[model samples]
Target: MNDKSQLVFCIGHCRIDPTDNSITFQMQGCSPFANETTKVSLQPKFIEVLSYLALRHPNVVTRNELVEQVWEGNVYVGTKALTNAIWHLRQHLLPLAHSGPVIETVRKTGYRLLLEPEYEQLNVLEDNLKIIEAKLDTANRHMQFILLFMSALVVITGVIVGVHLYQDNLRMIDTQIKVITQDPGSERYPRLSHNRRWLVYGASQPSGNKSLFLKDLQGDDLPVRQLTSLNSSELRAVWSADDSKLYFASHYLDTDECAITQLDLATNEIHSLAPCSSEMGAIDISSDGNYLSYISKHESDKNGGIYRLSLNTQNAKAERLSCELTCNYEDRDLAYSPDGKLLAIARRFSNISEDIIIRNLNTGEEHRLTEGLEDIRGLTWAPDGQRIVYATENSGSRNGFIIDIKSAQFRSLDIDGMSYPNSVSDKGELVYHQYRRQFEMAYYSLGGNVPSSLFPLLYSGGGHRNPDYSTQAARLVFVSSDSGYSEIWISDIHGEKLEQLTYLKSRVAYPRWSPDGLKIAFIAPDDSHEGNRIYILDLVNKNIFALASGYHNHGRPTWNWQGTSILASTSDGITEFYLDNKSPKVINALKMGVGFAKSSTEIVFSRYDVKGLWLIDLNYPNRIEPFISDQIFNAGNNWVLTKGGVYFKSKNSTEQILNYWDASTQQVTPILKLPRSSISGFGSLAYEPNSKRLVMTLDGFPQRDIMLLKHKLLQ
Candidate 1:
């Protein structure tokens, strides 16, 4: 629209890169050469789009090219995805974008990185090329050093030193992983009430199952009790004044009014008040249960808006308030004032954005409550009914502000970041889960004086990860979320230093810390090649060499006890990613294939079920041997090489039982029961051999949680 410098439109700004995960840039201090100060933190997809544009900066990337990079060529990131991200970005950063678009459009052809760059130094084009050249030199030198060192260690050191180095390398690769998160436990926020009588939160446990749990709001971290048994999807829930009925939204095919459902806790009966298949999300009801308001995503309306249903006369009028079109205005904030006489609505109409609009039902006239403040948050009328306070995420920080209804005055207050409550009681005290904090480790404290605080400390909201202790010497590595993208990251165990690994938009999966610990292997779907491939990252060097690309349908790669190579399972797969080569090389031609890699050398990997062990060796060529296949599925995981045999999960029929396989006698023994199939984040079952502990990753759907399931490992 506004053709200032070049309009750099980031479509899916929140996508993680595949090549190296760390380089994501969504909303930040500023895009190079721009004065924009505002940025959107609400959506991750938008961030991915920004990352893509930043990577290809100073280049004129066409819309189609933008789509491929941002969406990983997926249909989900369609027109809406593109436009929404672009629009939101403009809302936040266009002011800066006015100087010059880090992006520009080409009449035709895909997109090219605009030559313009504002690095405080080199021009944009020079910066891109310089980065590529530096990495190239680093790769060449690293390969030469590794080959020379490995050649000697092959027999004398026997891959002992090389493998250990490689194992540490895997740890370093995690720093580059992208950040992909959602409701984490469930689609709703944790709801806490003052009486401390109940600590409520939504959890989608047992995988694909959503339910609510209530726990003692007190001292002891007591066990949680299940409340609602709706196996389907249960939306946000709010407590009624009497606490007699829990009103929420549950949508299923049976209910025509898929919109509203009043769960009467007294009778445990689910009542459907309004019948409309409109998809419903955020809901806020009047304390007395007299009036209700919620945002509905419907097929007919196409563009989602605010809707209301009343309990009086069964609230029969049950109307759709198309203020966006009918009243020549758009409504976002839809909350009822305490007395219910004034509806405190956050309204925005295209050019004119977010302003609180108060509609007097008795007067049938609407008045602008808070204008010129594009900064309104989840608004709730104060208990006394005079003041309306809401959480506002303005500029780059999140805070709470209050507005007076009668006097039309506004005041701002600083509160803890947990202010993301969609529905709050009239009570000044709020109820919501505190936002997770993320740390950005910075070196050489700004001043040699004070305790060097970690830079970019999670002041507002961010997901957290367990800091890997003792790994400082080893290397702190893990998959992480950066600016809404998922990528591998490698850092000092202290998390004082971090480096990102993946650069492509495709998501990286199952980063394995090699036994030798020099290299890490993971799966990345390369839509460009139209197939999944294994990517091996060299930690010390930051060189990414595709072990295998589209040609191999292989996945879940694990490093062998010897770090020089890796072991992977697949079907009709190809060998190491072939780039310069014109022809394809098949590593296997069978149904379930197994393969191994010895540096540049590789052979098929297979599981000998008859002998009951994994049997793939790089030196064996087509031959497969019996390793240690038990009754359980050890062949699948990065089978742990521990003092207490190999631990793995075996899915017999209904249950995925945890079991251990003895290396000596080759005996299989069951350990403990598990929650579901596969570990969280698809991470391998980490065997703490020193402690003989069997640890499994607990699943945190929407977003994975760092959970440790400890058990005794049979020696």
Candidate 2:
């Protein structure tokens, strides 16, 4: 064998028969793997983190560095956590003799890998069957010319398609586009007239280039006009009581911070209020325009939170509305009730679900009107001002609810599963947006039930949270806490049999099938921590459980290079430590930046977080690294890692573009930009190596989208 083929490695759990050099696992009962399994488990995330440190430095990687990756920088009490994870790894692997070299301590630094990696060139042709392919071309004058021709065709053709569809969309809106202006794009937050007959939105068009515009909501032929414009000025305006004045924050680049500017809507005259700039949070004025309240994020004292600014002195009298010891509470969402006696504000970043909180000015006491909402993004007082309406989400389903100010009873508003809700009427009429399959729209209602299509199609895959359009891209698999409160469930793309996979009394998320389609590993509710833990379930036996006491939050586990034992894990709360515990210690953790060239090692799903999405090599020892690291949130990679790289989605601005990251270079480059939305939610991935098709899901207006991207890596 040539010495150049020394990249393959196995420390403890890996075994290679001399005759063929095919990898083998030491685990006794584990079954074999197939070439098409790119969807790996969650356990490997923990182990993958550890392997990165081992491969990158070859020596001890500081525990602090390791903990940062695992704990996400919360090193508060991490010393003890690191000790436990390492202790478990040593206990499990010491006797395996498979861990190529021992993990040695460097006194003060970190741990190190002692042995050399052990080997042969992988044949890429073997995995070609698994890929759903497209034409291949190298980047050059030819490819660029083809791309240019396609771009021009799409622009001309896509516009034609867009205009035809947009006409239909306009009709469905039921409300006319009273004003369509080429907006300046940044100005005041919009507020409508009390009668809901006119519209107000930030207008950043030419002239002031930063102001407001009004639209006749009565479906008129009125042209859009800039209501408030100031030369080279930046402003954000809201509605003042009486609906005669618009209040906004402005930045006087030359003289002041973003200050509050009020415009007499009746006269079209602007008033540059002192000290009310963009620096201060949103402000709410009294019904009589006598008193005003806004958030001052620059907390001067523990008690100085929501403040009242007087027009006379411009002096803000501050009061602490919440305590932050137990939860992260920030001042926001301040609004004036019709009576002007009650102030409604939303507190965010609090560990507990935030909500619409009302304060009685006279009593200086506050009360919460909403609860159990993971996020109370925004709030507003109803026309009657007796209720506080806000948006919420639970287990990925977006909805809105209104709370009775006096009774504190939450009446869930029957809007489509939507977001960004705001009341648009004084007569109890509500207008919000719901996502359709391809675009978003402004929906309207009169104080009651939401409108439903005569067509009964579920936009969000029937509320199936992370819908995967199957490996064959024919069916779907998603984990829904909805089934008896959030468990792993599989269904067809159109919502067929809602089969349950676990009977455990806890939640199961992030499920993945083995290459051979015989087993799955999932993140489940830990009987110990009551949080997430990794569990392996054999589909054949169905009764057995493989729990990883070694790692906590053992994310979705993936099979290792040999498919012998899973690439199990342990983490330092921040960084993941890859351990091939087929028998004992980590058999052989792969180098930091490598992927399998073998057909069988394509990563099932490249998982991601703040840092980025990662690609894994399955056919070898666990080697994990970043795949795409842009702001591409909530996406996964399904690939057939045969030769050059695994194919997945790359973020091209807000779009999910088809791209291939080479296994050899560990570098990703864009291939085709997918205009279609993804099939799964953020981070959901389904790849059929044979078909070479990758399916992903992403958030879209009114509905989540499942996207199918077909590609091939001929290079």
Best by TM-score: 2
TM-score of 1: 0.36
lDDT of 2 by residue, 1-715 (tens): 1111223334434433233323444543223332321222323322433344434446567878766765544343244345445543443334444535356667888766564333232243223313313223233557889898999999999999999988866544221212222332332344556676665655443222455567676665677666644633543345655677776666655664555567786787776654542532566677677765665544333422565656545544434455633333555567788778888877643222345678898888987654334455456677677876665654455566666788765656544344444443443444333323321111111123453211211343333443343343344455655533445666553456657765453345556555455556566533222234455655564532455354433444555444344443323221222223332334234222111223345443333323345555443435655555545422333332434455554443344555566657767665555443432233444444443444444434332211111111000
Model 1 root-mean-square deviation: 23.3
Per-candidate total of colliding backbone pairs: 84, 81
Give the winner by lDDT.
1
- lDDT for model 2, please: 0.47
Q: Judge candidate 2 at residue 528 and give its lDDT.
A: 27
TM-score of each: 0.36, 0.46
* CA displacement after TM-score superposition, residue 280 of candidate 2 (Å): 15
Q: Give the Cα lDDT of each candidate.
A: 0.48, 0.47
